[model samples]
Target: MNEQEFLASYDPRAYPAVAVTVDVVALTIREGALHLLLIRRGEPPFAGHWALPGGFVRPDEDLITGARRELAEETGLGGERLHRIHLEQLGSYGDPDRDPRMRIVSVAHLAFAPDLPDAAAGSDADEAGWLPVTALPGRQLAFDHARVIDDGVERARSKLEYTPLATRFLAPEFTITELRAVYETVWGQPLHAGNFHRKVLSVPGFVESTGASTERGGARGGPRAKLYRAGDARLLHPALLRPAREEAVR
Candidate 1:
């Protein structure tokens, strides 16, 4: 058919309507616990319910751009802070009835940042803050957000096993003890200190020594601990599997 005939025959409204959105599952460790960033919804469908920071994707923006834009809008994190955050596509969630208003599909993104400041609510959110993941069980999360948070948490837990992503949740330089705490907190279990230390050091390029020690002694008054920074390894050779995984399987 000719171009003019094809154009005239097509009907834009023939197909079912659908909308796309982006949601960010921003996770961080605060006070030795795992926390997820959330915003209180200000609009109906589920107004007042806490949810992952997100919004409808703008026609002019791509998925990742939309995700970052929604994050910045809800958290007020921009420039250096925003650029420093590690973001990745988590998954796409679009259960037929997930959205009450319409057939909406959301592309969720996962983010990790060193302890961040409180979030500032945007135009569509009533308030924004980081809430402990442990406290999410009984909470009323808007839409299918609770499931989204679960997926993000599982991704974080699994990534820490084979990737150096745990460092993304820590300061530039940290002690081995502090690094171990990141694992323990995210895994929601205790790790043997001696075993963890040995395994970490054995993983070449996992961390590098700075030839410096903390000015103060240990919290209980031992010799000063050595300081180290993230190394160049993209993946852990001998992945540090969570100790509780076997138990959970059983």
Candidate 2:
């Protein structure tokens, strides 16, 4: 068939309806533990169940925009706080039976934000808050969201080894100990303090000193530590591979 003839014959309505959605796996450290943003569904198909904050993509919106809108809406975050968050596409999940309401293809986005205040529930969510990642094992999460969260956590853990993305989980100026705690919390294991300190400083452009020190000493009362901010480098040279990964490969 000619191009014009083929176009005329096409019928979009003949195909089964499918919906696209965007879910955000927002992570941060609270009380020295890693937490994920979750919402209680206020509507049907799993009402009252906790799930990652998300919504169906609007017809006029792109995937990233849709994800950002959902994030802001569910968390009620805006202005400088909203702009400070770092977001990136994690992956897409589409199982024919993933959603009972219909066939849904979810483009999941991962976000890292500094410690935020209690979330204000949005229109679609009855309640919104940060849930500790370690506590998710026994809880019920709606619509295959548990799996999505697992993937996002793994992505965050892996990304930290080779990227400066971890800094997103902290304030603009942070101490090395604070940064190290971020790694420990996300990785779910304790990292060697001395080794971590050396590795972080050895990596060129990983962090830049702020030339200012904390007003007080360490939490235990020692000389104050110097502060630093995220540097310009996008990737780490001589990547700091996780110790567990090294053991597995050996």
Candidate 3:
């Protein structure tokens, strides 16, 4: 058959109708703790519950594009701010009964960045703001969002071990101490300061000295720590595995 004949014969209704949505798990460090952007739903099927910023995928846009759009609309992030976020697809979830109204396959995305501005609620949301992850257990999240948030946090934690993406959670120039804080915050544990500093410097291409130091001395009035910027290496030659994970594996 020709192209037109095949198109005419295709039956979209031959299978059960399914919807595709995009949810963003945007993470950042705020006040020395991990925070996530959440919006309170203003519509049905999970109305009035705090959830990740997301919504139905429009007909014309692609998956990643749709995810960005949802964040733009639901969280009121501008185009430039949205572009600064490091967004990547985490996975897709499509359990038969995941969504009460119908079958919905959510293409979940994970984003990380340096602390962002406060979120503003858009039309679909009653409220929006950054909530510390430690408080997630207290809030009633909608639409399997609790699970999604967990998965996204895990992804960020794991990536810190091997990828230099952790730098994305900081300014262009930062101190090793500041960088280590990012790992410590996301991993939910304190990393040894001396050990972390030595390992970071030893890692080839993990960071490069900027020939400068911080303006102020250490907290106790010690000498200023040297500054460094992200290096060229894409992967950490020797991954900085989580210490707890190491003990668990042993």
RMSD of each: 2.1, 1.7, 1.5
**lDDT of candidate 1 at residue 133, scale 0 to 100:** 94
**N/CA/C clash count, model 2:** 0
Question: How many clashes does the backbone of model 3 have?
Answer: 0
Write down the TM-score for model 1.
Answer: 0.93
> Which prediction has the highest lDDT against the true structure?
1
**Model 2 ranges with Cα > 4 A deviation:** 1-9
- Candidate ranking under TM-score, highest first, comes to 3, 2, 1
1-250 in candidate 1: lDDT tens per residue?
A: 9999999999989999999999999999999899889988898979989999898999999998898898888677888788889999999999989998899999999999986878899888888898999999867899999889989999999999999999999899999999999999999999999999999999999999999999999879999999999999999998898876645755
Comparing 1 and 3 by lDDT, which wins?
Answer: 1
Enumerate residue pairs that collide in model 2.
none
Q: What C-alpha lDDT does candidate 3 achieve relative to the native structure?
A: 0.90
Sliding window of 10 residues with minimal summed lDDT for model 1: 241-250
TM-score of each: 0.93, 0.94, 0.95
Candidate 3 accuracy as TM-score: 0.95
Q: In model 2, what lDDT does residue 249 have?
A: 70
Off by over 4 Å in 3: 248-250
lDDT of 2: 0.90
